[model samples]
Target: MPRRHTPGHLPNDRLTELRSSVRERLGAPRPQSVHEHTPDSTHEQTTYSAQKQTHDSVRGPRTAVVIGRLLGLTFVLCFATGIWSHYLQDPLPWMRFPTRPAVLYQVTQGVHVAAGLASVPLLLAKLWTVYPRLFTWPPITSAIHALERGLTGVLVASSLLELTIGVMNIYHWYAWPFSFRTVHYALAWVIVGSLLAHIAFQLPTIRQHWRSRPSPRRGDAAVDVSEVDTGPAPIDRVQTDHVPADSVPADHVRTAGSDRRAFLASVAAASVAVVGFTAGQSTRFLSAFNLFGPRRYGDGPQGLPVNRTAAAADVLTTAADPAWTLEVRGNGIVHGFSRSELEAMDQSTEDIPIACVEGWSTSARWTGVRVRDVLTRSGIDPHSRLRVTSLQTRGGYAVSEMGPEFAADELTLIALGLNGEPLDLDHGYPARIIAPGRPGVLQTKWISTIEVIG
Candidate 1:
């Protein structure tokens, strides 16, 4: 029977009776002291068993589980690779990214972008499969149920916004008033937390439908049952549920599994299509497959891609001024050199991949004076951390900090040439900072100053 409610606080006899009833039902002691203040907290559990027995739901638990697993994998991959990219662009104290593995950021960021792209189809499919459950009767069955829905809401909304931010960012679109990096980073955590909570609430459902059962015999109402025994409340457990004959979705009402199979296949194909073509920007071998990639891997001036041009940066005239000189400053010393003088300095050429946060990359032979040589000339320790400031007079990417590992690495340079010729203005002409394993944005094109720091 449903637990009865009365006016004011629960009476002592009713409270004691409720505790005993629960203890007997579970055959275990449920500590009631934690909710003693509320007095009627446990009363909500009344009729839960009876209600669950008659609960009607939309079928597709198996579909939901399968889509969920794939969606969750993309989320995890995107989050992990996102943190790695974030650390590279904005490392916390005591964090030092390696200078070797010159293409590490390229690979991780590529995976991150690809995972985000793949998630779109998977997310839509998962939402479609489970959307009907949002209308469950008696929505707030218990405190935990309320929590479960709240978490799911947050996960869905935040995930949508996060994906939007990522797609927009790749194209350098920032229509939002908020800082994209700050908001995107914060939302990542929120989405991940909500996802974990939602997963916890749905663990039982997931376990129940983790694998599909045999197709029901023709003419016996179609069902998407699991091989495992789910408890009393499953929508697919057809014989026990008292669902109305007309309430089931049409797809679930079909006798054969053709509809469900076709649906899953379509969603999978969409995911593959979205990821396969776009990933060519990052996957060199798949370059021929690139259809909508924002930038081709090897299709810009001087055989390299460019995110920001001199005109966009408002540095066209300034970058071209021959009077311009690269200054190295530290302590009480300042050493400056014109482009030709710096070019005349002992230069080393090496193949380095200029990788972008947008997931595009191309390797090029860069020739320039090593950073440590410039630092030493400024009377600073060759191993000291330094700041590379660009000729651009605006924006965050114009100035970037170099860690000691990169400053000391022989490959870190004030590049003066690309592909055996002077750099194009779009490719950071005169000179630009280029280091191994760094994001392209942080390469600080159109060099102006390098300052040593602690």
Candidate 2:
């Protein structure tokens, strides 16, 4: 019934049919291979299903948002207080600091240093949670993305330098070549600007994860939203369709959640620990608990921690000179007072905390002539601004500016005694400025002259 076929050859009609079938198959439009992708970047055709899985437990947008919020809060606090401190230190011609609180600078500076230290942990955690973005796929997907990444780089670099130098400054370490104040202040602006820009770029993602969204079947090998940057996450996901190599399988979903929780707990604990140890330096009662603080609040000459010893300032010889006298100079008026004369004038004692820029502080009983009384004796306006000079010949703080409120404050004193004892040779023996509501640096030590200024 069927035509007989040769072993190695087919009939002419059969061969023609076979050739035609092959030609049709070759000419038909071919389906794209799973490994192929176009330049438009609609989908990422990955050969390996696994993507990067580092820190998967804590590597998500949610963690980033939480840590970012905390880091942002501290940065805000640090920025606010830091600005206050800078203004106080370098007041503009029209600026005048308040005098009522008396310990305003103390509190503000303490907050500044405390926030700075607290940021250490928050910053580290934030970096850890978001570092994966550094290796995001299609690393330079577009020019806008490239610029966004550049912004992120600036934000991170400036933030690290800021926190690093801030911590160094608190310890009174000047290992850098640049002026800490100048660089620190400038970096603050950079950080704030970059931070704001970053937030604007990330608004969609931040809002998306501002509150938790429903999880997608737990561990369904989902793409990490945090890696999506500040872009519209839904759209980014559609385009990228990335699944991190480290994503847990559905069976391990609970384990992933547990790991994330553990990571968060660890970060919180670290922050608490850092605050516990360093914040105590500003709290007098917590002095015993402070370990890493550069100065102990209770341990120094005359029971006050002294950052710069009279010896270190090279004022030891000049301070002890018997002729050392505090001179009050004003418009056509000059009055000088020996240590005995200062103690002889009406003495005022104020138990106030003297806080250093470094953040350590101590409550001391300073008894000496009221600054207003001296200004009045010198026939000068008690509220006149002053140029206070220290006996130390060499030092940036050898001379300091004084606001009128300090001269007018009844509690402001040129102290010759501390804690019921005469000033120690190391404690500005002849006399030292002790003003309220100001930084200790302005409490110019080893006083030599006070001149009234416009």
Best by TM-score: 2
Off by over 4 Å in 1: 1-59, 214-256
Clashes of 1: 0
Model 2 earns a TM-score of: 0.81
How many clashing residue pairs appear in each of the predictions shown?
A: 0, 4
| C-alpha root-mean-square deviation, candidate 1 | 11.5
Best by lDDT: 1
Query: Residue 179, candidate 2: how far off, in angstroms?
Result: 1.0
Clashes of 2: 4
State the local distance difference test value for candidate 2: 0.72
lDDT, candidate 2, 1-454, per-residue tens: 0111211222211222233234334673321232233342222222111111212446666678878888899899999998988887899988888876877877888888888888998899899877656765556667887888888999999999999999988877789999998999999999999999899987765875676534443232133333442242224232223333234233344555577678878887887777777767778766777877777776777788886788788987889889888888998778889888887778888876788877778778998888889999989989889999998876667888888877888888888889999887667778888888788888888999999997
| Per-prediction TM-score to the true structure, in the order listed | 0.79, 0.81
Displacement of the residue 63 alpha carbon in candidate 2, Å: 0.7
- Name model 2 segments beyond 4 Å from true: 1-55, 215-251
lDDT of 1 by residue, 1-454 (tens): 2323222222222223333444546666443322232333333212222121112121265677878899999999999998988888887867888988877778888888889988989888888776645655445666777888888898999899888888888887888889888888899999999998988877766875576633324232222222223333332232322234343333333522465667788988999998888888876798899997877878889999888888888899999997999888889688998988887789999899888888788888999999888777767898887888888875569889888889989999889999899889999998998899888888999989888877
User: How accurate locally is residue 197 in candidate 1, as Cα lDDT from 0 to 100?
Assistant: 90
